[model samples]
Target chain A: MGNVREAVDSGTWSLPQWADQPPDPDLTGASFLLISYGDSEAEAVVQQWEAGLRRTDLDPPVLRFHASAFDRDQLADKLAEARCGVRLMIAGGQYDVLQAMATARALGLETGEITRYATAYEDLPLFCPHCQTTSRAYAEVFDWTDCTGCHRVLTIKPHYSSQRGSFLGVDTR
Target chain B: MTDQRRLRVTEVRSLCPEIRQITLEPLEGTALMGFQPGSHLILHAGEHRNAYSLTGDGIMPSRYTVSVLKRNDDGGSAWLHQHLAPGSEITAEGPVSMFAPVHNQQHALLVAGGIGITPVLSHASALAALQKSAEVIYAYKPHRAAHVDQLREICHSAGFRLTEVTSAGNCRKALRDRMSDQPVGSHAYVCGPMSMLESFLEIGAAAGWPEYRLHLERFEAPELDPGEEFALRVSGSPEDLRVPVGVSILETLESAGYSVPNMCRQGVCGQCQISVRSAGSLEHRDYVLTEEEKAAGGSLMVCVSRGTDVEVAL
Candidate 1:
């Protein structure tokens, strides 16, 4: 242990750096949750984690859900049922992860209890610094998009804002 | 550096043979900055400086209250008990938050051991002020037990019970039973002796309590054993400098006129981290480093950690 929860909650984990080996990392909690984005890469992540749990011989309480399977209310209900040590993992495209992160934060799960790994960077929520407007991005790092509010060409910076669950967009002008 | 506040002692009352509560008001200003609950302030009186946790409400407080346990040693507590008067003026710093309740906690479990009850009191006040519920467990010797009545009053309004114990065995049993009964999203905040804190942490981990959910504030630093003498090499110091027994590597470096970036010289803070070019074997006593980092032998927290035949890159 490292104070991973403190780093994430403080927003110092602002810069986006997905865990390189998400599935293999010693993900800990009393109970485990996997909300996959329905992508092939994300499904594989859930499968490996499930297999590891089996290998450990601890039949821990686990909840599995597709990103689209439940609405925010249902997700909150499910999270509420689990105790404090529910390790919530989100594996998906950037957009789905962003959408799910909002629900986690709202559920008061404001710690490293939640782990995220976005395998495909698509449909990310971009915050346009120029106009303070948020726009959906079908792009990844170093990609360009037109801001929906100002219609200005914006470049997505690698910096992440966990407080906003959105990518920082510098006006490319 | 933090700004120091000028305060005048407004009142002082002896709670027990071992405990005294002091109340302070601003020496000049009308109000003090509000602080987070479970935070401490360093009292600066003469040449002595010691941190005492605030025992009252942290919000818009008209005065600050702290309970001091008179120690047998000639430390700050003894000095304050002997010298502090109603009109005495002193300079202090902090309201620094080493321990604070998580605002999002569904339920809060607070534990206090002996004089460590100071911060736990502050947490209870904060929880009540915020209209939240908490279960407080306090263990102390009956003769010197402090704040039983006050803890009762606060817990009454906050809709929780305060569990008080006189013996160590009963304390352990109470903690074990309560640790298993907390609701989801519950958090535990503990302030106590080094051994008690260690035991609570171990028990919490064993019970599947997440590390982030368990908060701890230590009033005393861990007692590290003095190890075999070692030789040090640093950027600003001579190579193969002999470090003697009972002397920390940081102190040794400082005596040789080398200023090392450091704080909490007790090894809790990672401020004194230095790269280890190589080492024979490092006895890692610091809380800041992980087991993997300690095993890697690439870095050292010189404040308390010691190593034999170590070469420091920094």
Candidate 2:
């Protein structure tokens, strides 16, 4: 859509103020973990992540796999590494990565992803076969993958788009 | 300079199971004249507004109409679709002008994918009402059954050209053939998924329309990463200011007094794109730039795009 402000005035308009200097993301101690469901999902996720990462030199780490392959042990290892810095991981196809995250939390790992809804998961409890704990955090942060459970820090990257807010790995669930 | 009017919801009507038409009316005694053909409004539902094209002529007594469809995947769509209903009022600003097809052209062809048909549908309606010549190529996935019967009826009454390509055929080849057959001065408008938009851009550019004539509307959400803050040096300024992570470049620019023209700060319109003098990748979310222009790396939409610590002549 076009800017309605410009459509009306049709004259020389001013942009918001800015310095000519560019912004940096690495200095922000950033690393994003991109998790895709399968090899096919890798291209789009990678392209999107890379496009967003252009403003920064720090390339976010990516882990691409099918959700069916998500085991509790593998997820725990990824979450343990996120504590050193600000990390972003994108998982495609809602439940695979998210279910794995839920399982990792049940195993007492830092892995967590929540849904934004205020209600509880109405269905039967889906548990990690390893930990045998019913994963409840997925109820709040809907369809996202991150390791926020039992972690030292849950620092959310500043100024990130709210479109990804549903994907936040908060323990609020 | 009187106080300009803010947009308000005048009416909301559900056309189908997931399709709803929201009519916005400007308050009385407000200077909200109306919107141009092919423009869209950003309905501020909450923190972010999903940009929907103006499906109705803005000439009515200040009521702007936008047809919204509920997509299961998009959070913004899911929120607006699930929560919004008739008589539920919210803040409405804009009739933002991005991806407006240039007027007075011989043939204005519009291609839409699924719900991408909204903007083109509006444009075709306006063109036919004005007795102008235009064609619409609407592509829908198989069995989605998005309410196009009303749109077809509207197009029929208006006497505009309409073509629907269902799942059985290839849309890109059809588009390429139609585009090639058109004469000079024909402009194309595309709005859909990013991949579809990219494909159109690549094909349409190779088909040879001028940079200004090919309009596009992108539907992807702007991705933001606020890992680190940086210093911003405005042109013709002595002192530099520190911009913290998560603060938008437009907000930073406004705070420093160099105002750039922008509406729909969600990066849908190309208004905030600055001409960069250095090499950098642009996080393109606006409908303003062509794919060729985007690949050049000189222009970046400042509202959502971040730079790699290199200075550009804004």
Candidate 3:
């Protein structure tokens, strides 16, 4: 409910340097956990995160999951075991990271309790407003994406849906 | 003509020493319009207009029921309690919606304090009918816990959880624990005294609840803070109307011949929202707008929001 970092716009491609910094001291009181995709891009981001965490006294726990192997049930179990006072750091491709955020929300973690740093923008999770279906797209840049549900071309909107945990795609055609 | 319809009181019973439950039916012998859970009807008794939450079943409700807590020197409740008898006719405006359950929520946590339990009761009933999981925490004075037997029965039938915390109990700690245990996508609805509502909101937020997941319904109007006199410049109007120090923006606009649609004049309803063409030092007092909307200065609820001097697109 408190202020979470704003979604980085596609136009603002340069990531903030502070986003690479260790979790803020205010968040250090809780158990620090990191979730990252197993891809090379995400691995580089995790390395930075580990280096940042090592600079501090916190020995944070790290977990990596492949996009195909990310089991929501396992994540739910881990979240249940973490209980209260857990600060989570997430890094992955846009789609992978959004899936993790959705899981975190399902496990009762507020946006304020989780920090996200997008590692790769190659893939995006797009929600078709027409048929209310969400699918992934692989594109270097977001423009018009085809919806598998409605078979319509959708233009990705600048806005994101916190409820859907995905980028909203409006029917442009 | 007002939008009010005449209804006859079919039954009246004292729920507690200070609270009375009145049941009404349409005089035309037709089913009243279906209202969503947490909807309220405004009783128009002469010049006294007061909003009361409909406590009966929202789905195909046969009779509209409301519980009024009698207050000394309060003409509305006092007059209804003393003079209104069975078969007596009354005028009521609407089942306007200010609070309702968020759709597709995984679970619902309802918190009610004192007479604020009116709307919470309806929400619980609706959640039960929908077979959605719900937990209701009702905080009240130990001696003034009204309709406990009936509420327990309803919860039992609906498979919902009910926790009654008295004034002597540690209600805050209980509420905090419940909020902490709620799963993700769980929505919380609270209606109670201002202090209790504020406390629940703070506790829920601290326990990782998002703003969209939390709902509130305040039974009383917002307290107004004194502001300096200001002028309202209506678009296409020749004269700029002066809003006195104590007058609300809605009152000033109404006096200036603008029929601004409004309900829950306390600013809870978004009906009176008006686009602000330009403004100087706008003071926003409504609960409807988000922080970004308020900062953007594009619109405001004229019922409660004001400014030193502002130009509005009527």
Which prediction has the highest lDDT against the true structure?
1
Candidate 1 local lDDT, B1-314, one digit each (tens) = 35788899999999999688999899674578789998787788557777789998799988999999987668788888988989998788877776777877788899999988999999999889888878999998888788888998898974687899888888888888777666667899988888778878877876568777788787668678888887888755555588899998888888877778765678764568889988888888887666778999889889899978888875
Name the candidate, 1 or 3, with the larger lDDT value.
1
Off by over 4 Å in 2: A1-173, B1-10, B28-32, B60-62, B72-76, B142-147, B157-159, B221-231, B234-267, B271-300, B304-314
Docking class of 3: incorrect
Q: 2 or 3, which is superior by DockQ? A: 3
Q: Which stretches of candidate 3 lie over 4 Å from their true place?
A: A1-34, A39-68, A76-89, A93-95, A101-115, A120-173, B157-159, B254-272
Give model 1's docking category. acceptable
Lowest summed lDDT window (length 10), candidate 1 chain B: B262-271
Q: How accurate is candidate 1 locally (lDDT)?
A: 0.79
Q: Could you tell me the lDDT of residue B70 within candidate 1? A: 84
- Give the count of colliding residue pairs in each prediction: 1, 39, 0
> What TM-score would you give candidate 2 relative to the actual structure?
0.51
- The better candidate by lDDT, 2 or 3, is 3
RMSD of 3: 7.2
Model number with the top TM-score: 3
TM-score of the second chain, each candidate in turn, equals: 0.83, 0.73, 0.91
Cα deviation of B152, candidate 3, in Å: 1.7
CAPRI class assigned to model 2: incorrect
> TM-score of chain A for each candidate?
0.72, 0.37, 0.71
Models sorted by DockQ, best on top: 1, 3, 2
